[model samples]
Target: MNNAKRRIDLVLLPIVLLAAILNGYGIWNDQYANSYYTTAVGSMLRNFHNFFYASLDSAGSVTVDKPPVVFWIQTAFAYVFGLHGWSVILPQVLAGIGSVLLIYFMVKPTFGLAAARISALAMATVPVVAAVSRTNNIDSMLVFTLLLGSWFLFKGTKQGSPWRILVAFALIGLAFNMKMLQAYMILPAFYIFYMLAFQAKWRKKIILLIGSTAVLAVVSLSWAVTVDSIPESQRPYIGSSETNSVLELAFGYNGLSRLTGQQNRAAGAGMPNAADDRNNRDNASASVQGSGQTGNSAPSGNPSDDVGMGEMGRGMNGMNFPQGGQMPNGGEMPNGRDFGGGNGGGMGGMFGTGEKGLLRLFQTELSGQASWLLPTVLLGCIALFAGLRRRNITMKHKEAAFWLIWLLPVGAFFSVAGFFHQYYLIMLAPPIAALTGAGFVAMWKAYRERNGWQAWLLPLSVMFTTIFGWYIMQVYNDTIGAGWSISELIAGFLMTIILIVMLNSSHPWKQGMVIAGFMVMLIGPVYWAFTPITYGGNSMIPAAGPTGSNGMFGGMGMGGRQGNGNVGMTPPNASGDADQSFPSSSSDESDVDNSGTGTPPASGGNMFGGGGMGAAGGRGGAGSRNEEVDTTTLNYLREHNTGETYLFATTDYNQAAPYIIDENEAVITLGGFSGSDPVYTTEELEELVQSGQVKYFMVGGMGGRGGNSDISNWIVEHGTEIPTSEWTTGTDSGAGFGGQSTLYEVKL
Candidate 1:
């Protein structure tokens, strides 16, 4: 037994190494993965106050959108590693790899060694899982926390221990803190598994489940309750909430809005209505220029810089295209003019979810991410229950049912949910992997024994999965080349046929054929998984595919550059007509100059540049320049500092994030992320200026959302605008405000 255990462990080493390479390779090249969260991690490391609230800036003005648990872990890592992109991303990387091992151990106890090995490989190679693990998004860590909970849940069921069950529920609660209601997607699976697998009386089972429920509620709501109970004056306003309430943020924006489309509302209370504000801004812009530029327009000469804010706002608010919003050069934004509350159509459609229907998962937009193995998983589900009698419920049957329960509802949710990114599909990976591993063994054994319908499931599953993979490949033929898909289809069908022919032969021949068939089935996903490392992936909205046209991967190609050519604003044509074709550069390097200063200002291209929505080592959009502050500007601000609490204040976090990351100083983000959160009133702003807490105010950029415009208007009326020549050097204005902005010195 000991020797066998050693050999099994040896076999697992290569799988672990593969996961590490897929998740950790080339991560150091990432300067700052998702600067929004990266900035928060940097701020949290400053002191205990920011650390506890998960503050987005060192000043602790407002908290991040999510709860603090994951950020706390990231902050600890930044503390040890000195807060680089790699430092914060390190936690998720480790979590992703750890999930692979957990899948192996969880399966090994009941499903045997071969099943565990296959399950681990599946978890490691799913494209979306690898894409998310490479970034600092909370999904990878959330998945890990849930998987750990599953391990405990499985152990409790095996031993019938209520204590282990309670521990499992507690972990789920912790996962809720990680991502709120997303963690609860697995609750039904846990509940059903415990009721079916535990060998207690019905009354005892009900009592135990009730106890677990209480524990889950306690753990899940503990942080939210504590944060909500604190006085509004003492704590920072909840970032994305409509009423400055954490509970509302969780249940509304991050919860129901995930299912139903996000409603148009300001981020906090005492804010102007979103629709009215949007209309007023549209009328203002149209009256000023009559150029059809509405709320989406940035300052002249820097058209594409603010396009990311539109993308960010749409992504957060359900892909609502601004009315009459024209891209630079008169190009119309994609996805039609339907604002909010509608289903995205097929491939390259809105939200990357494809059409909302039963076939949604099979569509080109989503299939390649994690659904490549669904055909096999579905067939495996049938094979697992074949020839089973209701009276004889074995551990294998119970485990299979647990994974199926896990897969179906989550799959259904994604199929219908109004708002979600492609990376959220990582939730489907574990169950698909588990069922694939267990089903393969069960069907193989049935085929050898000639167990009727079970005998053909193995071959049928391989053929279907192979064909499905070919369809996904064909969708990306322009980027990955069609010849590769053709080869896979031929090789996969041939292997399946050969495996069927060898059924009457010896065990070794049959096993070889089966292994060959599975290998062919894995070819596409493995290649898709490698695309992130090869071409680079979007750290902000992580998706896997080749970069070129806006197909399923939405042109996320060539070192993580957005493929749709939404680079910095599009430039005008020779005839002065707006060029509709947002042309993208073929190169794999950032077009913006670093300006000889080691610290690049996080401006131009995407809001976070290559680190945010901009392309990695490529042009973010056409005519985009580096938005980093020039040395002259940095020196001016430092020299003119008058002991203010903040270095300077900007309308939005985008204008402020780069400085926070580069300088590690207090820079106030007045409008929060998306520049839409109403964090202050004009009177409060006047008070801040009067007390000398804030002296330098940047008016314009992506700030002044909703009710916050009063603050900007007040500053312009009373303050003095600093001359650009005094602070700017060269062509760069040192501000990527997504629009024209003026610096104002506000004094009594």
Candidate 2:
């Protein structure tokens, strides 16, 4: 190889290695990463039918709320590697590394080695990207598939081959199957870029775009067509859908609901949105009330009621409290109109919140994690346009246009989009990194030539980034104490001085200043990413950064304070009473991040506060025990399965996932996730009981999932509630299922 090529290879190798280390370092630490999906993977490994539907149980009773593409890849690895946590998560890690390498090659062909190296490193260190890649979540796969499509498109645009363009759109179709509509966000850029860059006549260009669009549609819907074609009886129920249809699940729950915020509450028996879910959880109790049952009903009140505030220090299950001040004289909340709040949280509200409009993406909860470099990236895109003005559009210009289009639309969408997890921002990382790389080089060239606009641009970008970095760290400081923010500020100040000195110094120092600026800005996010790996963070609502990580604090409180490790998700201290930081049960959704799975509530501006990390600790620790199965309850399930296809059935997948994962048995969920999707009618359930397909029904309550009132009501009326003490320990262990899972044997 030539000198320049060899040097490029050397830089590329280390960046790739860095990405692998970031993703692979604590692989074994989080054994059952995101137990909700991990359980589904375990079930999919059982047989072909379950595999095809992405079923959450061996009996093929119900499917996960997501598409099957991610599970398909995870299952293939489990098939070859024998189904360990490492095996399940291996695909994402490999995909992440491959993404970095692909980006390097894609940029190297156009922007050269310097831009390629910058882009690769920028993406490699992004906190949320590392967080998702290290777990079984499919966002990494979606990102990889999209990047892969970009690679093919890059080749097609260069070669002027229609077939290559067809392949490019086809890969995007594959990406669609991975993440539903999210994969389509970049298509406009892909189309416009191809049109501008393709060496073809106008008529030919339109024909090519039309052909690719057709290929895109055909490939995107192929899996949906086949799955929908299967008879409902033979396939698993589509979780989270109002109707038992994958297409509806995709178009409604996963598609339109995300944009319009018009939730099809036709399924979830009208549980209030995520915010009200938190209020209901706090003011009420986990115990459900029925004839001759010991559960408590909710008090008639709004979210502002302090009825149950004093019980916050009790335990993670947020139940078993003495009810008086918070309820009526009989230890029950006064009956009234249905709970307030709307249908949000869960899968339907993927991109919504009470907040909206342009600045929404910059909220503290979002900025600290994914948006650490967002401002600079946006400025870089603008700088690219300004620098290239009045010039004929070359292949490079078209490439720049593509990256900007890919970035701005998605950025604007998230800014104003209603509800979404912070990790969803991973989709924007690549384009941001690419634009920053190209913009930096262009600005640097102009600066070397003493061009006034370019000279000011580079320093101004660095200066603005330093100020933003300091602000983000300050937010981190307030949310998670221990003076971390001050440290970041000091470091940033030192870097700013170095940048100023280098900019004014001789030739050798100018390049060094650029490297310093990137490093200084990267310091905070890189540390945040490391926090999850070190302190351990894998939740249904996955986040990254110090706020996302379980930190130096022993236990977290709902107000985002350090607790005595009693009432929070962490085990109580030696004393039963907790450190008096706050009070409320674990059931309160506000205390938890809830992003990793189920229906995450509308996450507003907790952006920099590490507020979610407090709840992340309640998820139990990393390692083999991470799955948090109640051994006593699991053994009861195994012994009494009695030749039934399902070992037990619960209200929703979150309630059933631990048992399915721990026992590797078919633990069916009656209503699917959010307890909104009707997996089985009461009549159908009775038929299953008669056929011996199900026996023990694990009931009582599940957060957000109590939406399936009919099934819950049916089980209460027909099934015999086994006394809590009979089958397992009555005390809440602060682990899986919170309190003892209230079990009931269906009477034949």
Q: Tens digits of per-residue lDDT for model 2 on 499-576?
A: 555555576766776777667667777776665564444433345654323221112222222212222222222122
Please report the candidate that would top TM-score against the real structure: 1
Model 1 segments more than 4 A misplaced: 1-8, 269-275, 282-348, 548-553, 556-629, 734-737
TM-score of each prediction: 0.87, 0.81
How many Å off is the CA of 98 in candidate 2?
1.8
lDDT of every model, 2 decimals: 0.66, 0.58
